[model samples]
Target: MRVCPKSTSSPLDEFLHHYMNGHDATVFIRGSRTPAKGTPAWIGALLSDLMVPVPFPSHSFDDVIKDFSLTDVDFTLPNLFAEPGSPEADPKVSGTIHVVAALPKQLNFDINVTNIRASANVSYQSHKFGELHLKKWHAANSTKVHDDVTGESDLEIYSRIKSAPLTITDSDVFSEVIQEVLFGNGDIILDADATVDVKVTTALDLPGDSLGKSLEPQISELRIIESSSAAITLSAVVNITNPAPYSASIPYINIHLLKNGSVLGNTTLRNVNITRGRNLNIPVSAIWAPEDAGLDARKTGVDLISGYLSSYNTTITAKLHPKSIPACPIIGQSLSNISINATVPRLSAPRDGHSPDNGSKTGRGKGEFIRDATFHLFTSTATFTLVSPLQYDTITLRSVNATAFWNHTEPVGEINYDYSFDAPPGASTTPRLPVDWSVGSVGYNELLGAMGGKLKLDARANITVAIGAYEETLWYVGRGIGATVRL
Candidate 1:
């Protein structure tokens, strides 16, 4: 049809002759035309039209072949929930799908589809797993030529599916997938068969449209509220900075706390409203279970505590699992692949009605557990002001083995206290512990020379502390300790 001569009749004439006899015909015409010598030659065009004498049945066009496929499938479910009276309050998943179609030259034209509703069966490892149902969807743009060699066009459409109702058609197979994701390489392939219903419009002629922000979540304050043999309860004030202008009501969100790639415990947030720019002071409770993660978990937990007390920055990861959001398993399954890491804020200083110099200087800062220390030289004893890192629970000092030092490295005295004493919530003074003097050392001589006066010393201690039934012994170093030499 590209070389059809201007002198020839319209190509529709041949179709008209066949149409009156109720037949379809394919026609091809090529013309040879010579232009004026030494002048540029351009081909002329033809306006061909065909009119049907009678209406054709819908099935009559079924003989025409259509080949198309879908690719670039990306699905996501935001933490947003549906409103009432619209779709079910269950969480909804949304994404875009691209369709590619290869057409013959005769039928090449732009096509637009509207009023679409579709359903698909989701399968994992050859077993039916879930269903994705779309109530309505739309594509605002027309199909455009994607590949010239194959005469293929691409159409992109987006939709928020109503609900992804999951049914574990085969429990064993589903469990295997979950087990692999948790313990193995963390990947699995899924297949889907979709059926779509839409109204299509085509034209022989054609014509010619978060610049997005993310949730910047911050932990403002963290505290140890309670503890037991298996777990410690933590309450935190989370300041979630929602940079986007949209507002959402999160009825529930549950995620697992992980340490060293192990599930330590889980945290929950409920009935929270997110708005623009810094939502402040949202109370979140978490159960920290190092016991559940194993012995190494306890060691890691101790390391975290050690780092926090030393004014070091530490972080914990909140990972989403398949059962995180119990209301919607599909959303949970989709989100379980993501791990959101957050910094564990240091514990604030206890607000007791005492200064740092309550007899001896404590140099108490945020996360500092020990407030002050006093050494009695004549009696060979020492007492310390201990700050309990708990809201309502008392911390029991089960045992103490410590050494007092002078000039950073010279030992002066040592204490070995085996009896237990309770340090209630906030600031409390420890019982005077008996110290054994290292009489021959230079530090002891310095202490003897400074009798009736106070000298700054350092102490290193292995202290065993217990809360309820949980007990852990940790090593601590105290600097600039004040010791009063008594007669």
Candidate 2:
């Protein structure tokens, strides 16, 4: 309280009491001598042995509110499961804490009092809440999470209070204590605050086999079947263990044949079933026609027949969806789609007991083939006698050039002819001319036995004859024979 020296009374002077308590007042006393006028009118007071017993009223949740049917606060280390210690030994916790002030007094600490009087300062602290800011407030975030148990929002709040009236109550008869506290009329409520760190992690649901061991699905027993010049059929068996604890079913299995990573053909297998921890085998096949191969079926067949002597690469990829669970969900299909690829390097065929295939020899298979590569070629000459009655003259001197072919398509390489005589156009009675030609290795092979093991080379000969100025030209196609006889 401050002392005003110059005393005067006015309604305007009442404003000075605005800053003072109701117990405070403005008192005026006359001085023995006249006080000095025009003083620097500052207010000050001095007193000795003067003390006011201001009831310091401040309250908070007791260490543990037993009367309110509450529980002992607890704290534990986050994520460090199975720690050895007394979680409730500590009076205050770092996580959520429920504070209950005794019954019937601002349950969640809401206090209302008017015509308020303040004679002192007040302060309080909740060590359980500490100074850390609140992170999650059940009441503020979700209405469903807030109930009578969650007294307030638990939002962070720090208040420095001063000059609030003190309410005095009987501590006992036995309840006079709240009467001596500040704004003591309110309900007792529970306020929960959690401070510990919370964490959540997610990963694949496939834990492991029933034995709790890891597993990898497998495919085996691959085979090639019914392979021929016209088409190739591949058959393979697939097997997999149901790693999960539940029965599994595969609705479909799609197998693709890939050559150097390109698709050749694909086949699907359906309705593959499996029991938990057991093997499931599925037989699958793919029939490849002429169109399925990058090369013609004949060549593809050759490669297969030759046991892939030169070694070509092929890979088989299996795509499937396995349900590790029975139809009852929560246990669902295999966690993800499954795919496996196995490479069959240099696919080879068996070579034992080999014989010529009907198509291989006859060239009449469902596929096209080039001519066979086995034959002999030879060239010889034969003479023809000219016997026309009108022209009985024989020419013994003449020259011949020839070319020949066998089977209308194969060229009988060249011609080598032998003659008995050589006659000039005007000369004596001798007939016929000699020519040379041949049959190539290819022709010989096709006609070795095909053309009666013999070849006939033919050519056209043009000759001009002169009988003392009566000159005329004669042209004829000539023929020669070659035998592919054994020595």
Candidate 3:
């Protein structure tokens, strides 16, 4: 029988002894203790000088590890009784004691040994079995490897350590580690909210009246009574709408009267007073004489006569007031209305001359001859009324009429005087009333024969009547009716 020695010293005994007795063991241990719990006196002084936070306390080895115990110790020596039946094994009775001890008496210690043995067997079964086993064991037991292993990796070990006789369970260790790792570096965080507003608008396009509307004149009647002249009058009402609410002033009304392509007259509003929403009455009258008629002479005479001849023409026109306001407001403002009425006068011409048998020389006297005449159906009055704000407005009136007349006269020698011839009568022994004188020849017959039957005369007359509020004028003419005759 063989007795195995029981080792009482721990596995860390050699390391602790070397740490205490080595030449630099004091310095090394001091360096190692630098990470121990509580502030180091010298390190604290240095941190105070730098004004930096002091490091927190660290745990000692005794505080970290506890309940260390050996569960079992086993030893085996081969060939203890191998030669019992052989000559070479005459009396070789070598034997070794085998003792199995519980390790640390922890709950997981059994599992740990089983796991280690399994890993070692697995490593040994691989190629270069010895080397692989040695490498695995060395890695598992290495101090650097043990230091690198986190408490998270030793969960089973920690769990078993809690059941050990001298082990302490650290409940806050993980939480403390997490806090230190997360807060090791300073952190910054920001919280914020945002808001915004938007606005929109729209524009509109509208229509307006810039260019004015055109104006058309309204006439009642037109007539040509003579060949070259006619008595014409225009009647029209010019209406204008304000189309606005405010008061608006009309400038003037332009009136143009044309006859046979000729501008008979042009008239403008000389007086106007137009109220808002009201109509104004204006009167208009005009007469045109033939171009051939002597208007100058007829205008000078008191009695003006005009006769209607053939091939005569006439026209009339009236214009509305133009826009007067510098600026026109919206529609429905004040506006104006105007109208005109006309009446044409009668025209006539007397016979040019008296017949030889009926009158004396130089044609019949003014009262002796019958005056031929033509009269217009309409009377001789024209009125124009304008309603607006303008102070001064003008209205024009014109008229034309033509006439022709014939005149006849006897010669001075046609009437012969009957005288008593004393000696001649006695000589003749018979008295006769102008003997050999044609019967009824001594009076107007002789005059007719002396004037070559009867004298002829021609006459023409043109009358123009221009009338206004303040003044009026007329034109006329006369002429012989036929060619002069000689006896």
**Best candidate according to TM-score:** 1
What C-alpha lDDT does candidate 3 achieve relative to the native structure?
A: 0.24
Query: How displaced is residue 4 in candidate 2, in Å?
Result: 80
lDDT of each: 0.60, 0.30, 0.24
Model 3 alpha-carbon drift over 4 Å, by segment: 1-251, 270-315, 319-458, 461-487
lDDT by residue (tens digit), candidate 1, 1-487: 3324774434444443343234666555433354346644443212122223433222232222232222222222334354322335344433444333333344445555544566777676777755666655554333455576866554443333323433334444555454443344323556666665544444423422100223356664566777777887878778766543334455677789876687778888877765556788888888878768788877777776665554456677777776665555555665565565667754444676753553434454335666656677767787887776665567788999988899889999899999999998777888999989999999999988888777878778788888776688777776666666776
Where model 2 places Cα greater than 4 Å from the true spot, the runs are 1-228, 234-236, 240-248, 274-280, 293-314, 319-340, 345-487
Error of 2 at 299 (Å): 7.8
Q: Candidate 1, which segments miss by more than 4 Å at Cα?
A: 1-90, 93-228, 234-236, 240-249, 274-277, 327-338, 357-363, 445-457, 479-487
Per-candidate count of clashing residue pairs (backbone under 3 Å): 0, 48, 75
The TM-score of candidate 1 is 0.55
Task: Kindly indicate the candidate among 1 and 3 with the higher lDDT.
Answer: 1
Q: Encode model 3's per-residue lDDT on 185-251: one tens digit a residue.
A: 4321111111101111111112111101112233222222222222333333344432222232223
Instruction: Score every model by TM-score.
Output: 0.55, 0.21, 0.17
lDDT of 2 by residue, 1-487 (tens): 2324566433223432221112333333433232356533342112222334433133333231221111221221111121222221111122222222222232222221111111211112221211222233221110111136744322121121221111211112112211222123343232223222211111211211110122233344444455453455656565544333333334433444443333445555556554556565666666544344545443443333222211223334433222221221111112112234554432112222322222322221111111111122232333332221112233332333334455444564443333335332121223322323243456545444454343343333334432222223334333232322221
Candidate 3 residue-pair clash tally: 75
Which 10 successive residues of model 3 have the least lDDT summed?
A: 159-168
